[model samples]
Target: MSSYEEIASPADLHADCQAVSHRLQEAAVRATRPAPSIHFDERRREVPKRGIEISEAAQRLANALHLHLD
Candidate 1:
């Protein structure tokens, strides 16, 4: 038997084609429609201060490495 015979029937293929066509139509409609507008508040929110403390030995090592690179 050939691959064509593997398919159930022409009716099923027609139904699948119809479903794909419907999805394509829906996608086209969505593509044509304008995107929704996004609104941003003008006011800025305060952020908490954060700091990272490194050991003195690490800082000296980092400085030496930076000087070597330069």
Candidate 2:
């Protein structure tokens, strides 16, 4: 059977270490960079007016409930 040293020589290990270090440096640089800014419109979003009108009975009931709560 082949030994561990034979499978991965010193040169191979050094190259692997260099590749890993380079990747880590790239990741660190990406992490340090600021994220892009997102802007929201200053105007308020207009909600669609409800098409259905409340019945007179519902309005009276709501008024009664409001008076009771007050």
Which prediction has the highest lDDT against the true structure? 2
Q: Which stretches of candidate 1 lie above 4 Å from their native place?
A: 39-70
Write down the lDDT of every candidate, Cα atoms only: 0.79, 0.80
- Per residue, candidate 2 scores C-alpha lDDT tens digits across 33-61 of 98765555744579678788777787788
Q: Which ten residues in a row have the lowest lDDT in candidate 1?
A: 36-45
Runs in model 2 deviating more than 4 A are 2-6, 40-70
- Residue 2 of model 1, lDDT score: 82
lDDT, residue 62, model 2: 81
Given candidate 2, what's the lDDT at residue 49?
Answer: 86
Instruction: Evaluate model 2: give its TM-score.
Output: 0.49
